[model samples]
Target: METRIDEIGPGIYRLSTYVADIAPPAGFTFNQFLLLGDEPLLFHTGLRRMFPGIHAAMARVMDPARLRWITFGHVEADECGAMNEWLRVAPQAQVAHGRTGCFVSLNDLADRAPRPLADGETIDLGNGKRVSYLDTPHVPHGWEAGLFFEESSGTLLCGDLFTQLGNGSTLTDGDIVGPAIAAEDMFRSSSLNPNMGATIRRLADLQPQRLALMHGPSFEGDAAAALMALAADYDQRLKAA
Candidate 1:
C-alpha cells in the first residue's frame, strides 16, 4: 500500500492512494485528510484492516499520539472502522459524530465517549484555524452523514461526494463546472436517498475554496460555487424524476 501525502493549502493536507491495486473497486484506498490546526484533526480513517498502513502514515507526518480529534462523515467500515485503532494510538483523541449516528461504545476502543457534533457547529482550532460541520443527511450512503468545511483554509472534507472511477490517485478538478457536473450526475443516478439537493444547496452557501471529496480527487478553488452547481444540477434531475 503506497500513500502519497500532499499539502493542499495552508494547514490543509491530504493522504491519498492507500494502495496501488485497483481491483474489487478497492474500497479501502479512500482519501484520508489531516487538518493542521491547534489540535490536529484526522478525518475519515480507513478500514480497520488498514490500521498498520494508517498508523505508519500518521507517524510519517505526525506523532500518532498527538491526534486530538477523530472525525468522519458517517459511521461506516471505511470511514470510522479504525476508531478503536485510533484510540489505541491517540488515547486522548475524541471520536466525533453526529447525533443520529451515535454508538454506545466499542468494547475495545478508548474510554472517551463519543462527542455529538451538530450542524453549523464550529471546531475552533486555535491560532485562527476553524472548521464548520454541515449536516448532509443522504449525500453519501449514511443517514447521519455530514460534511466539514474549514473556514480559514476554504477546504471541504466532503465524504463520498465526488468519488471517481480509479485507484485513489491524485484526481483534482480545477475547472469549476467539470467536477460539478460529474458529481451531480453520480448522486442523481446512483443515490437512493433524498435531501441531496438540499444538502448541496447548504454546502454551496459555505463558499469553500476547495472541494475535498473522500472518494475522488479534491477540487481546488471556489468550492462553494462548485457545490452549488452540483446541487442545482441534482435539483433539476430530481425535478425531472
Candidate 2:
C-alpha cells in the first residue's frame, strides 16, 4: 500500500492511500483531508491498520503532531479507526464530532474528551476558513454521522457519500456522480433512514464547488447541482426499500 498527498485547494491537501484488489474487481482508496489553517484540522483518520502510511502522508505537509483537530463524518473503521493513534501523536488534537456522536460513542471511545459541535455549528479554522458540520446521521450510515463544509474554499468533506470504486484519483472534474451511484448500487452502503434524501438535499443548499470524498477523488465543480440530482435518485431508491 502506497500513499501520496495532493493539494486540491489552497491550504487543503488530500492524503490518499490506495490498495489494489481490495474490493474484488477494483482497488480502493482511504483518504484524509488536511486543512492548513491557524488551527489545522484533519478529516477522517483512514483505517487503524493504515496509521503508519497515513501518518507518513501527513508528514509531507506538516508535522502530524501539529494537528489541532481530528474529525470525521461518522463512527466507522475507515472514519475514526486511527483516532487514538492520532491523539497519542498529536497531544493537543481533540476529536471533534456532532453532539450525538460525542455523547453516544466518542466520549467513551476517544482517548481524550471530544469537542461536540451542534447541528449547523461553525468552527473557526483560521485563515478565513470556517467549518460547518452538517448532521447527516443515518443518511449514510452512523447514527452520529455528519459532514463538514469549509466555507472559505467551499470544500465539502463528505465522507463516503460519493465513494467511487477503483484505484482512485486525487481529484476529478467529470461526472463523479455516475460512478458513485454505481458503487453505491454494488455496495448498498447508504443508510435506509427515511430522511436520508432530505439530509442530502441540505448539502445542496451549501453550493459547494468541491466535494472532498472519502473513498475517491475530490469532485471539483458544481457540487450542489450534482448532489441535488443524486438526492432525488436516492429518494426514489430509499422509498422503494
Candidate 3:
C-alpha cells in the first residue's frame, strides 16, 4: 500500500493510503489532512499501523516533527489511533479537540494534556490559516464528535462524513453523496437519529468550497449542495426507519 499526497487547498494536503483488503473490489482509502501554516495541524492520524506510511507521506511535504496541533473528528481508531506516536515524534505537539472530547477521552488518552476548545473557537495557525471547531455529537457516530472549518481556504476537514468505498482521485469535482449513501447502506456506519440530518445541515451553513473527507476523495465544486443532498438522504432514511 502506498500513501499518496496531494495539496487539495492552498496549504491543505491530503495524505491518503488505499487498502484493498477492506472492501474487496472497491477497497477503501484512509486519508489524513495536513494544514501548513506557522503552526501546522494534522487532522486524523489514520490507523495505528498506518503511522509509518502516513509519517513518510507527511515528511514529503514538511518535517513531521514540526507538527504542532493534532486533532480529529472523533475518538475512533481510524480517527486518532496514532495519537501517542505523533506526540512522541513531535515533542511540542498537543492534541486539541472539543471540550467534551477532552473531558471524556483525550485528557487520559493523550500523552500531553490537550487543549479543549469551546464551540466556534478558532485556532490561528498564522499565515492567515485559522480553524474553528464545531461540536457535532453523534452526527456520524461518536458522542464527542466534532469537525473543523479552515476559514482562510473555506475548507472543511470533515472526517468520516462522506465516506465511500474506493481508491479514487485525491481530489475531484464528482458526486460523493451517492457513493456515501451507498456505503452507509452497506456499513450502517452512521448513528441514525432525528438530529442526524439537522446536524449535517448546520455544516452546510459553512458553504465550504472544499470538503476534506477521511475515507473518500476530497470534493470540490458545490460542496454545500452535496452536503444538503446528504442531509436530505439522512432525513429520508430516518423517516423510513
Q: Assess the local accuracy of residue 46 in candidate 1 as a C-alpha lDDT between 0 and 100.
A: 82
lDDT of 2 by residue, 1-241 (tens): 7779999999999988888878877878888999999889999998889899989988988999899999998999989999999999998999999999999999999999999999989889899989998899887888888999999889999998888888756888888889888988889988777787888988998889899988989899889988997888788887787
Q: Candidates ranked by TM-score, best first?
A: 3, 2, 1
Expressed as tens digits, the lDDT of each residue in 52-104 for candidate 1 is 77678667878889888888887678888888788778877987777666643
Q: How many residue pairs clash in each candidate?
A: 1, 0, 0
TM-score of each: 0.84, 0.97, 0.99
Which runs of model 3 end up more than 4 angstroms from their true locations? none
In candidate 1, stretches whose alpha carbon ends up further than 4 angstroms from where it belongs are: 18-29, 103-111, 167-194
Please give the lDDT score at residue 67 for candidate 3.
Answer: 98
Q: In model 2, what are the clashing residue pairs, if there are any?
A: none
Query: Model 3 scores what on Cα lDDT?
Result: 0.94
- Who wins the TM-score comparison? 3
What CA RMSD would candidate 3 show?
0.7
Clashing pairs in 1: 171-217
lDDT of 3 by residue, 179-213 (tens): 99999999999998889888999999999999999
